[model samples]
Target: MNIRKKVIFSFVILVAFIISISSLSMITTYHMKENSSFAKQVSRLINIQEDMNELINLVTIENSLEKLKNIKEKFISFENDFELLREDITKKDHKDLIDYILPNIRQNQNISKSLNNLFENEHAIELIFDDIYKFQNKHIYHNDLFSKIYPEENEKRKLLQELIFKTTNLKLIQEFGNLRYYSKETLYQHRDMETFQKWTNSIDEIILELRKNDRLKILPLFTGYKETVEIMGNLAINIHNIEKEEKILTTKLIKILKENRDESSSIEIKIEEVAEQFLSKISFIELILVITIILITIALTLYISSKLTSIIQKLNSGVKRLKDGDYSSTIVIKEDKEFSEIATTFNNMAQNIEEHQNTLEEKIKLRTNELQGALVNIQKQKDILENLSNKLAKYLSPQLFESIFSGKQDVQIESKRKYLTVFFSDIKGFTDITDSVETETLTEILNEYLDIMSTVAIKHGGTIDKYIGDSIMVFFGDPLSNGKAQDAISCMNMAIQMKEEMSKLRIKWQKDGISKPFHIRMGINSGYCTVGNFGSKNRLDYTIIGGVVNLASRLESNARPDQILISSETYTLIKDTIKCTKKEELQIKGIAHPIQTYEVISSGNNSTIIEEQTGFNLILDLNQIDKNNIINILKNTIIDVEKNI
Candidate 1:
């Protein structure tokens, strides 16, 4: 059981035992007092009965009128006393006293009945008076009234003499008269010493006789008185015994009380002792509990402190490593649940930091590589720009491309002196070719032809200024500073070479079963011209602007395929280096006057030329020649060209 329950249970049992013992002790004490009071009352009633018996015996013996009066007076007093005693006994209300008094009253009534019987019977009265005289004389002594009778006592005797003289019948008087005289004499003597002695003896005889006749008659009163007295004595003894017993009981009670009190005191002391012991035990338990709690708290604190210190140390180490730029530290604390999670999180954070650090390095490397690649690309673009500048200078002039590309805060353009050769080429019957070809095929062919023509121009120290449909405007002698005359001759030679290359390519295509023929027309002009970048600020072009440039374009437009038409000035400069044929004076568009043109016949030591008529010329002459005649001429020309090669 728990301590509290145990204590409560013990306290309840102790209280129950005490109450049970106290109740039993109280009941025993009540019974003892009741029984003791009963015995005492019985004893007192018996003693009263004994006194009535003795007084009744004295009254019976003395029967003289005088003595009777005295006895009567005494009896009256005795009756009064008896009445008082009876009242006293009745008032007592004790069972033993009532028992003793009730029979005595009956006995006294019997005595009164005996006295009345004496008065009623003449012989009985005479016998009773005679017996009383003898009983008194035997038992009484000293002085007697009747024994010492004399002449002086005659007057007292005269009343008795007169009673004798007054007798009526002799025969009746014979049994009574002499007896009356003797009765009077005895009565007279009963007053004397001897007579009284004789009367006392005579009363004793009567009493003895009465006792002899019905012993139990007196016994009822005597026995009742005796029994009452004995009972009273027994009661007294019992009361005394009770008192002794009460004394003993009181002593025992006192002893018991003392014992109980001592026991109670002991119990109280024991209770106090037990309480003290319990308190001590409780205090010890509390101390133990406090100590245990303190220890547990201390242990918990130490454990937490150790864990916190360890965690903090690890965190500090991690922080130090992180400060030193090492993002690879891991926390491995295995403490409490929360701390474990924190450690795990710390490890995860470290891992994340390390991963991020690696990712940052990779990103930095990638960004650096991208920047380097961009720089390399920019450098390549710069090189390309430089090359483009050089090419543009060749066509327009160095000053022109520079002015266009340079980011000068302020820019001004002035004409510079330079000898330049400008060339312009156009495809013959290009409109017809475009109309016959698909748009995609036409663009493809145009880009291919332009790419080839531009390559040829550039190869010969020429620059392509622009492309105008199936035409190209080329220039020389500026970016690459060769002799203008030589540049013109070189341009002319490239144009002729281009025509011959195309014719051979066409022949190869014909042999390979291609039906379409490709062709180009070119015009070259050499002159003194202004070359630079020229335009508004936002827009510009690097080109030659002069009459010679326009005249060169017009000549190229009028030339036939496989023809290199040069201006008169260009022919004058390159006539010695390249072969040319005088072509025609052509009225050109956007020109105020006609200009002399020539066909570049051949390059040095390779005097080969395709047909002078372009595809446009052939188409124009289509109505003049039959299809069969044209086919026959083409076949014959192919045979002749093959034999010469």
Candidate 2:
């Protein structure tokens, strides 16, 4: 019986020991899970808090009172979440856990209160902005009404003064006063009070001005209205402060509740002690059983850990190789059936990765080649364009090229030299011809004439300097070698050619049933002159300069169709090559001295001179000449020219 009782007691003790070990293991696992859950919750709360803070900062930077109000509503919602978290903590069975979490909850509550206060302050400022807007409207209406009564009252002045007063007062009393008393004390302490004092002085000056204005008798009413508005602004700010303070108090209360909910240390300690007492009750029976169980458990644990560690080490090595861009590496563990399957999956994944990596590398290489080709083509195109621009520069005179390339709209060339020869030629009766011609035909005709003249000028070593409407300005030398005498002779020869060419052109026109006469005038002069690039830095032009150039133009103005006139110097130079007739010395406009002029009588070739009183004839008195005789002379001259041709 004694042996049987001892055996039964041993059996009971073994059962109790087994129960204790199992309970301890379960408890440890539960504690670990609980802690992990709490940590994740805290992390989530922190992220939410950070997001809220960023939103608040955005609203503050914008100074957007409307957005601030919206954010305030969101803050209220966040506060509710804080309240719920606090309540959740309070309801938790584990008080020890609550203690660990209370501080974070309390911090979140404080942040919410701070944001609420910021919103209230911004709202108060918005009220002041509203007052400024109303004042502006009032000033606008006042100015409009006043201007109608006094027509020249300078109502704008009054409006400006009122605007200054209102803005200064609002900035001082509303913006500076409230923000200074609060924001400055907290954030920026160095702001000067002198600014506010100056604002008040400015308001007094505005009042003095208003009193001086006899037409504005309602100054007292205006003053009273302004005072009331200021009072209202102050009252609004005060109420906002009170509300903010109330929110802060409420937040503090919530923080206290969170603290109460988080008192878990004592409970955790008691639980541990209870577990220890229960464990001690089975200590004697558990000693031998625990030794044997521990030996077996250790051996099983080491064996399993070794297997797991081997597989884990292989996976870690594979991951490292992947990080190093070795997609060919793979994990392989054959210790157990489960691990073998995992290894197989890992090897398959490595193969896929290797294939994908190769494809990606090939695609990258192709894309790089394409980009390189495009870059080469773009560079080649840029080079070609640069070459074209340089070639175009050769056709332009230096002054024109500088104006175009240097980004100027116009070019001017000025010269200090006293003497220059100038030539001006125009298609005679161009306006009358164009009146019956189509616009396209007219443009074509003008382009043809310009092309011919340009070719003639270039052939004679002359510069086709400029075109003014239907006229041409030609010079002997510019941006190249000087050929003044040679250019004059060549130009005379070109004029003779032009007259011959025009006769044929006229015949063609008549055959085509056109009735407009095509005649041209040629003028030449040589004297001291100036020339160079001239005008503002923004615009410049290259042309001959001086009184000599002007006189040449005057001589051109005096010439008639099919006629070429020259100054005395030009006549002397060309007398050996061409025939000429001396004309009487005549006084030209804007000239202090009279100039001797002559006509090119002939080209010493087949060219004939048509005498029709060519050039401005100052010798004949218009008042004394008979109109019928003049008409008869003109008719006879045309018949004579036709016969000569």
lDDT of 1 at 338: 58
10 residues in a row with least lDDT, candidate 2: 610-619
Q: Write one digit per residue (lDDT tens) for candidate 1, span 1-645.
A: 433354456556556655654554463344334434433433333333333334434534443446644654554454455445445434544344433422222223332343233223322222333344444443323133223333334443344334323433343234334433433444333323333334234323433444554533333332232222222222222222322332332343233333333333332343334234323523544465556556655655575466567768977887788779776676676544555677678777877877778789889999999999999999999999888777766554333345356753134444455788887767667787667677976776677666666667667767667777777777887655667667777777777667755665566544554356767777777887787667877766656788777777767767777667777888888777677788768777777778777777776545342442333222113335577987899899889979999
lDDT of 2 by residue, 349-454 (tens): 8788878888999999999999999999999999998999899776655445665677753344444573456788887788888889889877876777677767
Q: What is the lDDT of residue 201 in candidate 2?
A: 42
TM-score winner: 2
After the best TM-score superposition of candidate 1, give how far the Cα of residue 315 lies from its true spot, in angstroms.
45
Candidate 1 Cα outliers beyond 4 Å, as residue runs = 1-414, 505-516, 584-594, 607-645
Deviation in Å, model 2, residue 468 alpha carbon = 2.0
> Under the 3 Å rule for N, CA and C atoms, how many clashes does model 1 have?
40
What would you estimate as the lDDT of candidate 1?
0.54
Per-model lDDT: 0.54, 0.57
Superposed model 2: Cα runs more than 4 Å off = 1-419, 604-645
